[model samples]
Target: MKPTRCPWRGWLMLCLVWASGSASAALPIEHWTQPNGARVYLVRSDSLPMLDVQIDVDGGSRRDPPAQAGLAAATALLLTQGVQASPAGPALDENAVVEAWADLGAQFGASAGSDRLSIQLRTLTQPDVLDAAVALASRQLAAPAWADPVWARERARLTAAWREAQTRPDTWAGRRFADAVYRSHPYGQEARPETWAAIDTAALRDFYRRHARPCDARITLVGALDRASATRVVDRLLAGWANHGCTALPAVPEVAPLTRPERVQLPFAAAQAQVLVGQPGIARDDPDFLAILVGNHILGGGGFTSRLMQELREKRGLTYGVFSQFSPGRHAGAFSVSVQTRPDQADQAVELIHSELRRFVEQGPTEQELAEAQAALVNGFALRLDSNRKLLDNVAALAWHGLPLDYLDRWTAQVGAIDRDRIVRAWQRVLHPDRLVTVVVGATP
Candidate 1:
């Protein structure tokens, strides 16, 4: 007897397999401009019993007043710590906020990076739990506590941390590297000890109003709800957020080619010298971003397979590990190669780096290397969106950078299409050997 022909079920099975395979690319996103001036990005997923929401303000160290390098960061730190005393509801201080989230099995935190400040929350999808979490979170965001006591404590704590960071070689190296590469650009400004000392409650209030305005905020919600429900919950919570007239991100000045290499050394008693080198890199929205990203992987970003790693670690044994990065900002940010090595080997390492950098720029990656890199990046793309938090982060990044909504969908294709010649041309345009700044701390004189 012949088996029954069930083509309909076979088709359904095929679709299911395809959907599972295209999980990362087919991420359904509902993005829109909110009525209250915030840009919101939402993705509904009932896969798990929780929801993740992140709010990004287009204000970070980049928006700080030139004189107050730490103000923008300080402002973000204070937003989640405020509370209002209402006879109707519970006390909403920072401690109360923490306890309420804990009681609901939710997590809440804030982070300030170079270009933005983000507040993240993860809570159970249960109606009561989500509702309470949203209400508590909104109180702090819509109407901040701005308590004098909270300001004093947070300021003292931050100031102490800043002062203590000076003692750390890595921290100091980072600050120095930024200063060397960015120069007059706002991205280069270091948080002065005096700036932290000067920061007061008044400064914090003004900075928050100017930088963290409602219009500059982008909200991203992912996981555990339908679009309509997510919209209602988010809109209801943030509807009252009004944008006061205050400019956030200012025009970033153009970065000029360095007339000569800049080498600034800070004497520190350590076993290894920390070195940083490179010049101005591409902007966040640069058209050649994919080309550069793929090329970078073959040069130094690909751990053991990287040219720099193979030469510096495996062949010469100069140091344990050396890494490269491109920190793209509103304007061109730093493209840096950094390593730490014995004081005696610092000079040798720097020459090897320069040699590899020059050769990479001239020859680019081989076909085999490019193919391997493309495979590595393309294969690993799914991991970038494996979880709610990771997906939320990518969505927020797209919203913040004004990238195409389908950027992630096209990422693998873009990487795979980049040939050796295209990457080489991209490097030729970006990497300038003559102008690269070389900075080494604790190198032998």
Candidate 2:
């Protein structure tokens, strides 16, 4: 007897296996604007019969009013909670909506990040399955119920979780850090229980209507579909998502830089102290992005070998681990170094961190350090695109940032070309050592 063939889920696994071997090579991105005004980016992969789609709009937390801090997040979440009845079908309660996707063996969900509200879908490319999945997703996107009871229940649950999280020291450190780093910017506006309570179904609907428009969508597709099939998929997915005549939203101002060093120390009953340091970093479109990325790897991003890790963890045994990263987004995002240590050692750890950062900003990385960071990044670049999902994410980011279509093709070259001078210049231009923000929670006051 012959072996049994795998089903849809198994086909996806097979696709990953097949794609992994070739993922290291550059994927050609096809671009076009749909008649409906949506921008679509495609990476066609015929390795298996599956499709992954991501749709992004400028409906993120940044669009939320400070008083309604989580309005965008709530809107995205409720999109799939229930969908209104339509000419094509009856209404779908949250449970029924979930079951419908299950029956089709497809997945669809929405989320809000700092700068984008995104809806994603994955389905087998069998003609009937793809069509049904697309149609269902279209309905959910176009006709969210914004039901009162559902929002109430979700809000209660979220509020409960938020309350619990507040009890933790790390949460306090993070929230306080964000406030100091962003000041009056929307990026600093974290949702509280009170903020969640302020958002109602009506607010959600209004936010969805204003921000989730076709003209603002950046859609990315990666799968076995050709350009024609992908176009059809997009059309069906956004069929009735008519444009609202590209009305410009009020311009969100850039994050304001700190005028001087700000320090916050909060007392708590815990054995470990949570320490966060650094300041506002670069935007995703910053010219020094690659240099900052590479330089950071040498300073703190790289594990074990990073200067921060070596100084704080290896040499002093201050903590188990310490890491730094730049959270680059649509606007300037935070660059932070975080570590946890004994409550008594909080001041020492912070001082050492500041000392290391100041030294790095002044002298930059050594020639050997730059070479190693570049080699590690270049050699490991293939892993970043070793699956369909990864490819979809990369393509989506490129589309969102208006980056060169060949960006991925030049990733390794760009990373390899970073010399000491470039890294030094980039770091010097971006980071300000004197104006760093330091926050310590659970420290001995």
The sequence of per-residue lDDT tens digits that candidate 1 reaches over residues 1-445 is 8554332334333433333323254777788876667787887776665678888886778777777878777777777785666543755778877666656666677777878878887776777777877877776666667778887787688778888987867787787777777777778877766776677778877766666566777888887788778778777666546677645556756776567777777777789899888988988888899899998888889888899999999998988999888888767888999899998888889889899999999998888999999999999889887766677888888888888888888888888999988898989999987777887778656
| Candidate no. 2 TM-score | 0.97
Candidate 2 positional error at 325, Å:
0.3
lDDT of 2 at 32: 96
The TM-score of predicted model 1 comes to: 0.90
lDDT of each: 0.78, 0.90
- Each model's TM-score? 0.90, 0.97
C-alpha RMSD of each candidate structure in angstroms: 8.6, 2.9
Off by over 4 Å in 1: 1-23, 86-90, 245-249
- Backbone clashes in model 2, listed as residue pairs: none
